[model samples]
Target: MARKRLLLAALAGVCVWGQAVPDSPGPAVGARVPGFDLADQTGQSRNLHSLFGPKGLMLVFFRSADW
Candidate 1:
């Protein structure tokens, strides 16, 4: 039946993905992080270079926008 085939496909996909390695970027020590472009609360796209020059850069990822 189609339901059995779908269930088997899902299980096979899960098994394949489960065997993959985890992502571990490790800790940062006196490192100059890479810059990324993202939009602000005003829905405007802003690049990191506009905020900091090529000499220095820092990134802060918070859980909530209130942070």
Candidate 2:
């Protein structure tokens, strides 16, 4: 039982330490994203305003915790 607990604790520590550290937290809900001119997947230049639709745009950022 003790060995199992130790192993579990070690695993937990490793998981915690492996997480990515961002410079700062993400934006607040309904916040405006800053304008950016970045290359798209197809190697084309794209900006925040250029992607807007008739109803405006909704962007989502996804980053793996342990990447």
Candidate 3:
């Protein structure tokens, strides 16, 4: 009985860890995205609110500069 309980606990831990967490979020099937803040090309600060101001925004992520 003790060995059975231990095996069940180990299996439960493995199952939990195997579950996936999304690397990206939002727009599951064409949804409006929320505003966010980030930096600009020239080292200047930028934000979605400032760019949109009363409009909407879109974002695309890519790999560059070893990032």
Candidate 4:
């Protein structure tokens, strides 16, 4: 029964994960990202401008199922 409940909970989570909230919709594709300054893992300050490439920067986000 515990295993079954976990499976159902996981399914319910997946069902709502892709529903986007209109007001808080994040940066759209092909849209320019606003300037931001943050510390990198190496403890150095970095901004979007510093990371620019010949084409452009592509940010990736990895969401763990455990969340």
> Which candidate leads in TM-score?
4
Ranking by lDDT: 2, 4, 1, 3
How should the candidates be ordered by TM-score, best one leading? 4, 2, 1, 3
In candidate 3, what residue range of length 10 has the lowest lDDT sum?
20-29
Worst 10 residues of 4 by lDDT: 18-27
- Please list the residue runs of candidate 1 whose C-alpha ends up more than 4 Å from where it truly belongs after superposition: 1-27, 53-59
The candidate scoring highest on lDDT is: 2
In candidate 2, stretches whose alpha carbon ends up further than 4 angstroms from where it belongs are 1-25, 64-67
Write candidate 3's Cα lDDT for 1-67 as tens digits.
Answer: 8767866866776688865534234565466566677888887888766776355545566668674
Error of 2 at 18 (Å): 15
- For 12-44, candidate 1 gives per-residue lDDT tens digits of 867887755333243445566666788887899
- Shift in Å, residue 6, candidate 2: 36
lDDT of each prediction vs. the true structure?
0.67, 0.76, 0.65, 0.72
Estimate the Cα RMSD of every predicted model relative to the unseen true structure: 14.5, 10.6, 12.8, 10.8
Clash count per candidate? 0, 0, 0, 0
Runs of candidate 3 exceeding 4 Å displacement: 1-25, 52-58
Model 4, 10-32: lDDT tens per residue?
66766778554353247754677
